[model samples]
Target: DVAKGYILYLEDISVSFDGFKAINELNLYIKEGELRCIIGPNGAGKTTMMDIITGKTRPDQGSAWFGQNINLLELSEPEIAQAGIGRKFQKPTVFEQLSVFANLELSMAGEKGVWTTLTATLTGEQRDRIDNVLVKIGLIEHRYQDAGSLSHGQKQWLEIGMLLMQNPKLLLVDEPVAGMTHQEMDRTGELLTSLAGEHSIVLVEHDMDFVRSLAKQVTVLHQGSVLAEGSMAQVQADPRVVEVYLGE
Candidate 1:
């Protein structure tokens, strides 16, 4: 049996929009409990690749598989999400009017296909899980505070907390440190680093410093394909990477 140690596998994925190939023969893999970062210049198909993984855009060719048994290309977007793949966009989207606790509660997947008030009766397990996530997100003290009142970083954390409520096996985060203050970025880095061993995380970011702090493996994309992949030091040392970054 194959070890089944990989959380995600993309094999020669290619996507074309209006006859122009945005992603071409992209091959990538993320191991279980690993934190990987994807970096690329503009037009590198970074966003399109993410969309393909999340089922927003179907690839024109190749395969995307989750774990050993699941063929992701056959799943719908919501189905993919339900299969323990969580994605966070560059912008924070939280329930502004809802209190922080309420926001997290609404995100609980165990509640079935319906929306309920935070004060509604919840199973003991559900309540305990929410409480634990609140603590992990560092918002236990502000549980009752309105999410709208939180700082930018706090709102971002709240959104992440919401995603955490679903207990995803893999997290896809895009530009998490963008527009964040240095202090907030450091905290976010710590939070993501802590999540590595528990949840496989793939971070797409342009910030080299942030990637250095978070990535165990880094893949650089250019011209709709992987330009280089390795540790930050290894990729940075590649002449192709240097020429790509500095020559332009």
Candidate 2:
């Protein structure tokens, strides 16, 4: 797998906040189209690691690369995003008053100065892509509905759909299933599973059962660095992981 050309490569990344180290000598990688799950306890540097990857937080040392050619550390936050990395925070941030379709349309990665109305000259190819994403996100029927009218799970999906409009190469999603019912969680799991093979996904989630259902390669972080990496069963049986969960 070393030769598959990883979409993301982070080596020896370290970062500190104030007097405390939030990330220490972290090394992580995600192969093209791989679905990876990250699980960790509080203060485990999960968010900080994402911040580093997205250029929101600069690491004290080490390198972050989008591919062999691009030096992620050299790019600004907006530049990194423009380079095909999209991140979804824990909370949904859709335009409540806009229609679902409008929300997705506004999230287009190109020049926002182009004006949402009055025909920004989208290619037939681009329009087709938007139509397809709407179907994939299960929002086709709700296209005309105000985003505020969608349920929580639907809102989450809309936000994800908005991210998809950017056509990102890698998506960093945090706590996607939080505040959802079991049915919503299950559907969300299916959606994420469906996303694999087409995109590389790094998911940070807490629901063990949901993680098991997705069953992608799992990485567990502790004390600002990687503590364990394996399948669910393998990590669950690790003495360190078991002890940490039980002790906390």
Candidate 3:
């Protein structure tokens, strides 16, 4: 019953490193086509939780499910990825020497082998998809520019666009707006919000303003478990949340 209709679910999940319980008896659920925001001060098991869901780390106890029938805990990292869960790291990993369009072309769904990838040709649909993603991320103007020449914010959007090529069922984005201009932050918020109903998104971000702007539901993690869950306004008003952030 862990999954139900959730795109992702964790029930009584616990994990340890040495003697420290990184995640203890954690329970979380994310509905299909919903964008969920997860926030915490630091070491609240956010990364650990993502690792567990992606099968990069196995939990010491409890269950993790992807959709209705997929047992994420039983799958390996590659298998989890192939199952339509895409993860973006805190830093952009786009090919700096490649043009934005080329980078996206390289990310299209198919065999990733070097020979096959380099020789593959994009069909009409794939080209249209890339063009649409370019517009969505607001990188249409820079489509032909080398990734190295773009601003940090543009690079981030390009990386996100690369992820879009996979047509993932769920997107796990980490600190997406960490380094960017205020204008870029607002645009990034818009980009993420636009993807909600089409693709379930799980964002781990420290930017309160950005979270407030984009998050419909916010989950606060402290001491490796949920301290509160609500809208940004509701959670900010919670005395427990205030205490945790202020160390009171």
Candidate 4:
């Protein structure tokens, strides 16, 4: 039954701003433990979709669900965050003054207040998790370094490490490799690929090369709804998708 459950699901979702429909009758689903890439042109409603799922924006109509019965539309933003869903925005927002290790430690679940977690000691289990996350994110060597001192790409990796600390069931990542070098992009591809089977991921990215490297199911969004869905090859071959995206 593992494959029968949907980790994230939306039905007839719509969002509008001043009479302009940002997301019009959007319907999408993500399977558990699947890494799905979402690519779209500007105003394609990618951000609006993430916003609705994360509780930042409520839809005008339709239902959003986490798992089977959990209604995403009824929950507040913090409630959604606590319900095992994690999101990483395009820009990295690490604590510049804190060490990489400290940032991850602070991001762990429980007692999330700034001053309280900063002063609390990590239990053995917490330490182990942080250590493992550092390794997984390829930041063990930089664990003690000031997060502000890292390069743009390194900071992105560190932010991802912070997300791992919570052990969320699903992660929504946005444009993770925007400004990285070729080497950094490849490493990021490897990192995201390694996390797929264990964590369901919905990534919004514009980098076709990076998306191709991941080689998973790709979804193309146009005018606020799905225009294409399948392997990258199939999506590229779709004339409608080609005209709106690849052809550009």
lDDT of 1 at 73: 94
For model 4, the run of ten residues with the poorest summed lDDT: 1-10
The sequence of per-residue lDDT tens digits that candidate 1 reaches over residues 1-248 is: 22378989999998888989899999988999899999988788889989998999999999888988889999999999999999999999998998998888889887454445444688788879989988887888999999999999989888989999998999999999899999999999988888888999999998899888765799999888999999999999999999888865
Instruction: List ranges where model 3 is wrong by over 4 Å.
Output: none
Report the Cα lDDT for residue 242, model 1.
Answer: 92
**Colliding pairs, model 2:** none
Write model 4 residue lDDT over 1-248, tens digit each, in one string.
12347998888999989999999999998998999999999989999999999999999998888887788989999999999899999999999999999999889877668787788777898899899999999999999999999999999999998998888889999999999999999999999999888999999999999999899999899889999999999999999988996555
* Candidate 2 least-lDDT 10 residues: 111-120
Off by over 4 Å in 2: 1-4, 112-123
- Ranking the candidates on TM-score from highest down gives 3, 4, 1, 2
- Badly placed stretches (over 4 Å) of model 1 are 1-3, 111-119
Native-to-model Cα distance after best TM-score fit, residue 101 in candidate 2, in Å: 0.6
In model 4, the number of clashes is: 0
Per-residue lDDT, model 2, residue 160, is 93
Q: Best lDDT goes to which candidate?
A: 4
Over the stretch 1-248, how does candidate 2's per-residue lDDT look in tens digits? 23347999988888988978899899898898998999988888999999999998999998888966779999999999998999999999999998898888788777656465336766787777778888988889999999999999999999999999998889999999999999999888888888877888999998899899987899999988889999999999999999888877
Against the hidden reference, what TM-scores do the models get?
0.95, 0.94, 0.96, 0.95
